[model samples]
Target: MSTKTLGIALLGVGPGSEPHLQSLATLADSVDLRWALARSNPDKARAAVPPSTRVTADLQEILADPLVEAVIVATPAYTHLEIAAAALAAGKHTLVEKPLDVTLARAEELVGRATAHGVHLGVVLQHRFRPGAQRLKQLLDSGALGAVQSAVLQVPWWRSQEGYYAKAGRGTLARDGGGVLLTQAIHAIDLFRSLVRVRAVVASQIATTAIHTMETEDFASALLTLGNGAPGVLVATTAMYPGRAEVLELVCRHATATLEGGTLRVQYHDGRSEAVEGEAKSGSGDSIMDFSPDAHIALHRDFFGAVAEGRPPTVTGEEALATHRLIEQIVRQGKERAA
Candidate 1:
């Protein structure tokens, strides 16, 4: 029996493109980075590809290749559903970047199609892959952490005009999804949901106060009651200057788990705390800052592992639907208050 190579075709070569390439490089022997489909410009795709990789402007050509086993939908927010749907229909495993889709309806469409097609449908919520997060997961599962009680997420980052203008469709309701919470803060929120095991958000109040220029909320806060009956607070603001200082902290009966700067810190009731380290990137200001790439690398490893073992991917489509629903609820509730 030949070891099957998972052929991956990258659909977008935009800002968060490098991480997937790095994952392909890191997992070179396991998965093949066969092709890149840029938007009508194969040159950009060609430039982004490492040697022995094909670059094409035609997504159809990539999809038509029998060797291509999966499609990584790193396209913009709005195009995720369409691209992912196409990939799933093509019988390819689909890994979509975050936000999944702009609205709950589109998200359902993609999630539903993937389910019917019986292909692996995963989202890149990579923060959950950090060693700190893994340790926390183990601790919680082992009952070392008694029960999650409360959580707080603070994502204060800044974005400038230059970063907004860098892309034609950025920060718009149509393209980038919402502001910080939707694009930037969702990572923290998703991780929060995972740590606390939030199944259903009961009743909540949402408020949006800062950043008026953008179509969506730049600053928003919400109070949520998780399915397990834990209460938590989520606050995301892009109005803060000097770029990113993302933090996700959860307080359980046994320990206080905190994640920041790719490091997860846990202070246990037994008087022991450990820190998990992550890779570093040098960047300044809000507009150009993101953790999607690191998340993608982590996501890739898990997806490939699942494929190899014939198991489900970590952040499955159904799981992602809950995250999307949470965001949608917050945004809708915030809008109602604003009205």
Candidate 2:
């Protein structure tokens, strides 16, 4: 392992950026958070970050700093491609928050850009770092669960009308890309895709609640065909009152596994059962900023390690693009049916 400490910069200082800051704070030995670049207000950004960090309103300042070896793009969904492209162009390893980009084309472009620049590019699908999720992946990969016959994923979350949606770009297409499916449920969606390949989908979407006036759907459901020729189901919504923990249930030939509330339960056909506990604080049912920093910290550790070792991070740009492509297909199917 390389002993070199990575000099990291944060591109956004909004609510989404808080997790990055918290994680970096705990990883001081491996990373130096050199600068924070906020386009709107530098003072507020300074206040949000630690005292040791520098604050700036200009992107050029972050790019010009040779000491800044990597950047964490925590900006809006629509801004991911532009910011990540610029960072890669500057020869800085880039770690984007999620979805890679709002669209497949832009995400692909970013992957190409990162390749051309010879820099590490990663996405923050922190759920992959969750203990329960990790164990589930291990079991599936080891064939301990046998052949997966069917799978179901549900993300029924809530965002307060007065607190979350009141923000200017909460659920708008132009800034946020999409509603619950893209923002809230994308984590679960990515986790699902990590475990299985979704070959085909038939989906329906709607804005069924008056919780917040938004341009995109607050609810979506899909029937899917997996790569193994098994059936799958996905349901994502922000309209559920009081919200609930996200769940992913996988039924295999010999065993069944269910992950909910950061806990994993597996029951074998022989009538034996096992339970594994995950992080105490589940990010479900709370504000987006309510997540614990443990997973984010793990993600950053792996990202920095990959950058130093000249290897791809856990969630590469191309890997994240696959989930985006699936999301685009689902949205397209829904639009075609509505038309």
Candidate 3:
């Protein structure tokens, strides 16, 4: 393993930035959390960041710092491309929070820029780092599950009207990118796609509830065809009451596996069954802040290790663009059907 300590900067001081902050704090040996840039009020920035870290309003301050080897763009979705591109151009390894960008074209452009700059570009799809997810992936890779026949993914998460959507840019198309599917369920979506290659998607979306007035859909369901000729269904929504655990069920020729919350259950054709408990916590149902930071810590560890070893991170910018492309397809097909 490489043994280099990297200096990092974090952009954006919002709630989304919290997990990154918390994760980086534990890696004092591998990383130095150098600076923070928050476009919000100075008071809020000060309160959100560590006392030892310098807080700035200008993005240039971070880019100009020679000691800053990497940057984490935790800003709004719309700002991802600009900030991440700038960081890559400045010779910093860049890691942007999920959804990569609102559109596939911009996400692809960011990936291209990173390649030209020879810098590492990572995306925060932390679900891939979860213990249960790791075990499931190993089983699939080992061919123990045989030929996968079908899969089902459900993200029945909840966000209160007053607590979530009422925020300035919570559900706005210009900032958050898209509702339910993009903002809330993208983790499960990315995890599912990581395990199975998606060939096509036929989807429908709507913002039917009156809970919060948003410009995007609160619910979406998609019929997917996998590369291996398996059929899959995805149902994602923020309209479900009391939000339940996100679930992904995979059915194979020899065995079937179900991942609910952090638990993994697998049943074989030979009358054998196994259950593995994972790091489960209340999902975004009760509060959007209910998630554990364990995955983030693992993601950061891998990212820093990749940077030190001069290899691509586990979730690269190009790989993340695939998820954004799928999201675009779902939204486009939904619009075409609606029209």
Write candidate 2's Cα lDDT for 241-294 as tens digits.
788888999999999999985789999999999888975445555466776888
List per-prediction Cα lDDT, in the order shown. 0.76, 0.86, 0.85
Model 3: per-residue Cα lDDT at residue 70:
91
- The reply for model 1, stretches above 4 Å from the true place, is 1-3, 199-212, 279-284, 287-295
Candidate structures ordered by lDDT, highest first: 2, 3, 1
lDDT, candidate 1, residue 295?
Answer: 56
lDDT of 3: 0.85
> lDDT by residue for model 3 over 1-339, one digit each (tens)?
467778899998887888888888788777888899987786888887778789988999889999999999998889998999889999999989988877677778889999999999999999888888888999999999898999999988788888788878878878878888788888888899999979998565555477657888888888999878789998888888877889999999999999987789999999998887886663566466567888999999999888888888999987888888888788878878888
Candidate 1 residues 1-339, lDDT tens each? 126677788889876667778777877777888888788667767877877888877778888999998878888889998888888998989889888898789989999999899989989777788666777788878987778788777777666656662457666788877776778778778877777756554444444344445566677788878657888777777667765657778788988887775777888888987878764431225435344355566778788777667789989988888887888888877777667
**How accurate locally is residue 180 in candidate 1, as Cα lDDT from 0 to 100?**
67
What TM value does model 1 have?
Answer: 0.91
The clash count for each model shown is: 1, 0, 0
